[model samples]
Target: MDVIARAGRGMTRGQEFRTVVDGAWSADPAHRMRWEMSLAFVAASEAISLPVQAGLDIGDRTPMTAMLEAHFGCRFDTTSVDLDTEPLNVATRYPVVTAFEVIEHLYNPLHLLLQIRAALDPAPSSRLFLSTPARKPGFLQSPDHFHEMPRRSLEALLSRSGFEVVRCAEFGIRSPLFCLRGVRPLLRCIFEKIRIYELAARR
Candidate 1:
């Protein structure tokens, strides 16, 4: 019996969520999520007209690192840091950092964000792209989720971390159209899509 694979069944961690029990990566929801996040990052990167020369992916537990690097025309160092037990360390200064749906799983997301800010290049154009779930239609405290952040709380954390939010675009909508099959724009609450934000270091 595939114990390791079995242990990962239905897990919400990055790698586990991207992987299938039979050792295949599903492209349905997981890949789609990654693509959307990459789109956000690409848009953010383009906004500042800064090439993603060297970046860090805070918790990219998937194989999309290469794809993301290629898409951004640069390399992104990937990490699978255990936010609960591991201390945040910035090996090298990065002009760009991405933390998709990672902060909610950490005990002290603000602290982590501050640490990440410290590691970012001091250039005003340097950016951090992040996303996390909102409080609406909040999921129960499961083995995966530590906490959810509403818009106010999310903004507070970024400000406290000395990062200025450039944009915060909500995606999910909770509406009848969302339930309808083959809807062009899925209707769900902004919180549901995990609020994606583009931020820059304070001058």
Candidate 2:
């Protein structure tokens, strides 16, 4: 099956859902993931200049929704897409869409990107905001990420998925002193960064 081939083996709907929920999904910000969310919001604001009528948030019930609500003046909605199973069907197209820290968790991100492209509002100012953990040295990475894409690779995937890159930024989530914790932490301090992209659908 193309879904299996593209997504990876053994990622049946049941399997992927279990894997995702167990490790990646979160309901709300317990306190804050200050670095990640703030950075993504900044990128999103700069990406779409028009007033946001509504948004489709991919991972439902996460901090992304609230941060986006604030960014979009609390006018957003969520599709709560099960990236592997549910399609992004909606009565209205979203002017803004966000999937922060979500691509790495997915068994297949391309499918979701393609869906967002197809479902985006046709207005030229409509945009999608996606962020993923940057590819790091092996010692600095999570064991479970389905993809920690290099910047270029991510750009290429977006291009092929029918999005044109508006901008991309890379930054660390922690201070330099975060490395002082351990040898591995040192590697993480040097290599750990998040890449956020602002994209608009191709003409």
Clash counts for all predictions = 7, 0
Q: Kindly report which residue stretches of model 1 are placed more than 4 angstroms away from their true locations once superposed.
A: 1-31, 37-41, 44-47, 138-143, 173-191
Which lDDT tens digits does candidate 2 get at residues 1-203? 12221121113344432234321334323214533554455655655764467887665444545666776674666544466666777778888877666677676678888888887999888888877778987666675576788888888888989998787777666655666888887787677777777788999
Q: In model 1, what are the clashing residue pairs, if there are any?
A: 172-188, 172-189, 173-187, 173-188, 173-189, 174-188, 174-189
Q: Write the per-residue lDDT of candidate 1 for residues 1-203, one digit (tens) a residue.
A: 12122111212244332223332433445445645565655565555554567888775444555656766678888654554445556578888777766676666677678778888988877888887766655333324555777788879889988988787776652344445644333323232555788898887
lDDT of prediction 1: 0.62
Worst 10 residues of 2 by lDDT: 1-10
| RMSD, one per candidate, in order | 5.6, 5.8
- The lDDT per prediction is 0.62, 0.65
